[model samples]
Target: MVALRGRVWDSGVMQNGALSELFGRMADVMEILAEDRFRVNTYRKVARIIADTPVDIGELLESGRLAEVPGIGKSSLAKIEQFVHTGRIEAHEALLRRIPAGLLELLRIPSMGPKSVKAVYEALGVTGMADLKAALESGAVAELPGFGRKKTDQLLKGIAFLEKATGRIRLDQAAEAAQIVGAFLAEIGQVKAIVPAGSLRRRCETIGDVDILVTVDEADVPRDEGRRTMDERRGAAGMGTGRMPVLRAGETLATHKGRTPSAQEAVIEAFTAAPFVDEVLASGPTKGSARIRTVEALVQVDVRVVAAGSFGAACQYFTGSKAHNVALRELAVKAGLKLNEYGLFDGEKPVAAAEEADIYKALGLDYIDPRLREDRGEIEAARNHTLPAPVSLKDIRGDLHMHTTASDGEDAIEEMAQAARRLGYRFICITDHSQSSAIANGLSARRLARQVKAIRTLNEKSRDLTILAGVELDILADGRLDFDDAVLADLDYVTASIHSGMAGDREKLTTRMLKAMDSRYVNCISHPTGRLINERGAMDLDMEQVVRHAARTHTALEVNANPWRLDLKDTHCRMAVEAGAMLAIGTDAHSAAGLTLMAYGVDTAARGWATKKDLLNGMTVRQLQVFVNKKR
Candidate 1:
């Protein structure tokens, strides 16, 4: 109901993530209490179901259909209802009263499960990590059932590894992971749809976790159907097209159908045991949870499957910004209708249950793009029918910031250019690193001069492709440009960036970037905040001021599409657009094979709610040059 577009409101994807954690905690507490295995299994099943669900549990309960959902029953439903209404579960509180809350920390260690912990607590009086460590050191836990010296050593190592993964991962990391897992599940004969949900779907810059939703054909039950494959359409539509193996439509799955097996169970079994998965946290027919080992870190992944009738409802519910869904739920309430993952209903009479578009239509708002579901004003825009039609991967005319063997790039300039041409690009800029980045084989002034000459030399012979001389100029800690203006004047594009000093003072960092942007030689700022997904934190710079200055100076802010650094973050891109600044989407590629990665940045820009009008690369070759010149 807000009038301003993209209005800011503190929000989240509350229920699925929050409840999942709660249930996981409950499971731990039950195990610590050393309760019967059956009671613990019951809560674990509920957690799995809640984690996989697309909609809020409260919504399902409020609609009086909580018990009808698969895996939900009278006992579990009562606990969920009690927890939702009272903010505390009596059983959980009672357990907490008996056990030291600190003991719960033991479960987070990969090697420590409830039974293992229960045995230790009863044998050694160990209740927390500190006690557990002391017991391990004193040979106190070695003789406990299922506890061995080797296992103790592994737990010690696992504890240290767990501590390192405490913060957020770069959104691209989560997206890439989902892409890998989603692509893998797409070939499962029983899985009808595979869609990523949660913060990854909302396209947040940093992701806390990942969730993927699927529609399973219960009757087929994963029979290795020859028809289910990653056709060209799926390859293009799904994630990591270039990175993972695609399952062709006609390929055989090595296994045949089991006798009357449940489709959901079959898919979950395949997913939990996928080669990319490191560990299975929870597994059931309806939902699966696992840890995926990426080159960066072990990331948590969740998969939820819904029946076909509730597929659209599940998609919308799971792909949520808690604030956005809450807004929609409020809207539905005003219209005298109830909305849940099952579908929209008016007093139990079905309204829209099939397509997401129809659900939005039934709610009287034009379909709001998932990227705009941050409650930043998309709802009001949808009401006004003025929602932005964001720039798509197809709208890109060129990739402007890339490298070549002239610097650290794996491919030569000519090879990168040829790859761009094959992608039907009108222009490509050779933005190899300049003098300061020695590790990247940075180019010296003389080397840059030679590279520029070669680029112009190649452009003359090319018919469909236009090559632009560019430099990824380094900005020092003291706010000085690596290449002189004399060098920049001759180049078609210059991307100024901070390679080091990311951990310096915030005000100083902002000033340093502002100084770089003030230079007429700078066309864009690459990976404005030099964050490596999950590995490091963002630099302490004032992005609002930097974006405003870019708007004023006509310098473009780059969305570096390295999958590791989708910098400028979608929010910053939105801020840039709000300040009338233009954006450039670049793969910041170091090789020819990196061209396909532009889709990641395009996806990020769309999340920022940017359109073709907001992008500099959307311009034709001649037009791009004019824009460059105009900035100059």
Candidate 2:
């Protein structure tokens, strides 16, 4: 029987199967060649369909159903069958030979794609990391088609970081590091203002590293002798004595010392001399900016000195989006002037001095606020600017929503109140989770009373900040508050929210929300939609009806500042503002650091064009108390 059995199918059939595999591989090769993502995706789609078809592709071809598969047309099918018959694809092989294999890897670079990589490789013979490094070292990369030294340095640094730690560090982690550095600098007494800028300031989902810029007093510069002594004695005994001598008023030192050194000069020198800096990018006698390459990302620190009056303007100019600044420059150009990181200029000459207000005046516009400086029609609005007076961080007198150990917060009531007082806030409400959500250690009725009593005890000790006992009561499926009116009436503020049954029908959800709004003690709705960004969908609700009801009842809507849940998103905020419903921006901080998230919320509010009048929290401490008392 074995002898009788002979190969029924010829080698052509095997070749046909091999040709299909080759076509699939060729499609991938062509995709990488063209860098046309949409077309590449289409080919990948066809390949996947052919691979996953129920019937054998060979049999399907025999049955003349190859084109019947989705994403596969007659042309594609012909190519597939041809590849199956032939050992190679002539065109694909030719492209493979022409394109350096290393160029394909460059496409993975962030902020750069295939087109840019191809351009770079063709112009500079830079096909991969090895070639790129050699070219950069030889100054060849900088001399390439569109790249300068800045771009070359950036590319090299980026490649190094990518090869080391490729993924972005968590935003919270980056903030933690910035906070540590900020606290250290703040303790130096001479430091006036220290701020974290760049991607962190923009509140990106992830950050590469942290950037902190500090302003110091001009009178704090160390004398040359003092610096030399400190440098020489750094590892020797009496180093501490050297530091003390710099501060001492010795007659010998006074007579010999030159004119007092500039504080700005000293700061510049200190930063350049720091061991943390890998290289000094630029420096000036009185002002300088340098980029420090850290394991995470490049940290750019710029230092400048101006009259105290002009400090705010400098800060605004330095902290910017290039696009936003470019738009400002274009506006200046149209008005027969120029704009730069320093200030507005009249044809390369300083016109309005270093004052931001003067610059705005020179542009024939009301001072375009820095918070609204995202180039989102801000320039146009400035020309005919009827910009709504924005709500400032100072105007926020109270935070109505917060958590404590009763739920997930790390700080106790007293600790949080002290932190809030340091920030000049007038009042804060402790709104812990209600009983339904046991996972968060939701408070039972007895525990709520105990927590309220604790808040009262802390309130008596709180010197400037008022403490409001509140509860973030969870709304049940039937639209009932977690606590009854008796318990709710005992609290200063109540923020009702939906945490479960998110997938409920629209009518049920709307009814649930409406019933909670009817409660006399409920002051606002917290994160109405219950979305967690890319995770869950927002609960269905009749938003128009909900807005109307909130307006009718004088209930406020909360714009939660939690990064993961920027609920009451810009669109919803605009609608709420139009509906005459006041908005509350709360950081929902679990720790002291979380309070800083208020800036993000404020940015979001600005994007929605919310004015001070539209924000319930944008009031003085006394005014906030009056509002709460009136509600009571």
Candidate 3:
């Protein structure tokens, strides 16, 4: 029976293109073998591409073309072909049997790696946490080479702490913390500028700590005006105009006049010494920092001060992906100089000390935008000088799709419109959910008409922004649109999307989406694949075909900004952009706070290398109005 079940599963996987299943099995095997994280990640990435690929995996394997896929090279292609030919992956199976399965879970503990897991297993016969703790109490862990009493205690504490604490906090959490600290620092008269740096600035999925850089002038300093007169004079002269002077050295003097030389020092002191901080580290007058344990995660806070003129460049340098900074350094080397947190130098001589943009310009490239500096082909792109024009928050003139009180949204038409106008948006389309989404107060014809009337009234009263009545019409089970053509046409902008009956045959899903796209009044498609991050999987559909249809029909696809969704993700956005499909970055905002999520949508768009030309919101107010009129 087991053999028969295995055969059935293999046949089904072969038929449906379960490349991820095979690759995931292989990754599990690699984990058992204690393979490096990067190698494991490569296999996983390759698996994802294969699972998402439209073509049959068997056909690709037979064609000897698997290496053509990104992140999959000769080594991976061989493994894939081996799995395709023989139902067994030998290396993975061997590793699986040799390594205890439970050890894989142990590796997930913070600061614990495969080597440590293996060590515990071998030394104490501890394959799980319960056994490991017994070994720790028995002093077996301390007896191991390099595992001293101190290290053992820390590991035990880490195990206990991580068991109760969340493993990693997302980047958004760090951003929130930074905003709080920034507001506090802003109130200080000495602070000239404060900007977040480090992984938080790079928008990494998780951050180790928060680094805030600040600039300040001597006049802004509060106390000890006369005693430290020489230090102030040096700060003024060495700081250079517009640049915050980096203090070489200073002494602690309590004059009570608020004579802080470095803004970074001030911010570091303020946050580290705050009531929220559970522990303080190395508090000094010049460069004190600390770690604060919040309910969500532990945040390491650091502050650095530089001359005012170089603050922007310094912030950019410090907030870098080390790999990106290294690439920039190499570029500087080729130009006969060195680059650092301060600024660029020519043969140990300060040549140009201005902003980050100026530094990039001096490197003989168009200013490399900070957001694009993720070290992923950006260096080559910069060298080839092919970087797209940086898309700004200002380039967005309106949100093409949003929700309101008519649906799940907290705000009414007038309130949402007023909020949009306050944020400098010229227009907003209220796209309430169709009747299928009854939970969101999905609108029927009569309710939709009432909402339209309210929007029209708001438009009449508002001079700065226009409010367009819209509907997020659902794609029903029968591959047909939720609302009839008559109802769709009554609205100013129509965004048709799939809500229910998400899982289905790929061809059926594709047909359903195509049918919606074919509608004359359908202006855009929301979320496109209906994926919720780390939760529900995307609906099975031909994404390339969907993008092509959207382009042909002049229907835009939305990159939903809600954190949980960022759907029509970066890769899909790039594909849609390449297909000439106009893309819209919408908050799909259910509340006024949701509007601010436009940045996340924009980030996803930029990650996809999208430029203003590729976005529907990039259009001028007049152009967008004309487009809406055309849809009508």
Q: Is candidate 2 or candidate 3 better by TM-score?
A: 3
On lDDT, the leading prediction is 1
Query: What TM-score does structure 1 among the candidates reach?
Result: 0.67
Q: Per-residue lDDT of 1-632 in model 1, one digit per residue for the tens?
A: 11112221112223444455566677877777767888788888787677545456788899998788887888778878765543335566566678876576677676687778778788888878888888888787877767788998877766655467657787656765675576567656666666778888777767887988877665654443412332332344332312112222453343323233356655666677565676888876578888985424468999887888877888899889899999999999999999998999999898988788889999989998888899999999998999999888789999989888888876788888778877789999999999999988899999999988998899899999899999999999899999888989999999999997777988999999999988988989999988765444589888889999998988999999876778878888889888999999999887676776787799789889899989988998777778778867
| RMSD versus native structure for model 3 | 21.9
State in Å the error of residue 600, model 2: 5.6
Report the lDDT tens digits of candidate 3 across residue range 539-614. Answer: 8889999999999988999988776677788778879988998888888977664576687788778867789888
Q: What is the descending lDDT order?
A: 1, 3, 2
Where in model 3 is the C-alpha error above 4 Å?
A: 1-172, 188-190, 202-208, 216-267, 280-300, 306-313, 376-386, 453-464, 501-512, 529-545, 620-622, 625-632
- Best-fitting candidate, scored by TM-score: 1
lDDT of every model, 2 decimals: 0.77, 0.64, 0.69
206, model 2: CA deviation in Å? 6.6
Deviation from native of the Cα of residue 454 in model 3, angstroms: 4.5
TM-score of each model, in listed order: 0.67, 0.53, 0.62
Q: Per-residue error at 229 for model 2, in Å?
A: 9.3
Q: In candidate 2, which residue pairs clash?
A: 19-83, 19-84, 20-84
Of 1 and 3, the candidate ahead on lDDT is 1
Query: Candidate 1's C-alpha lDDT?
Result: 0.77
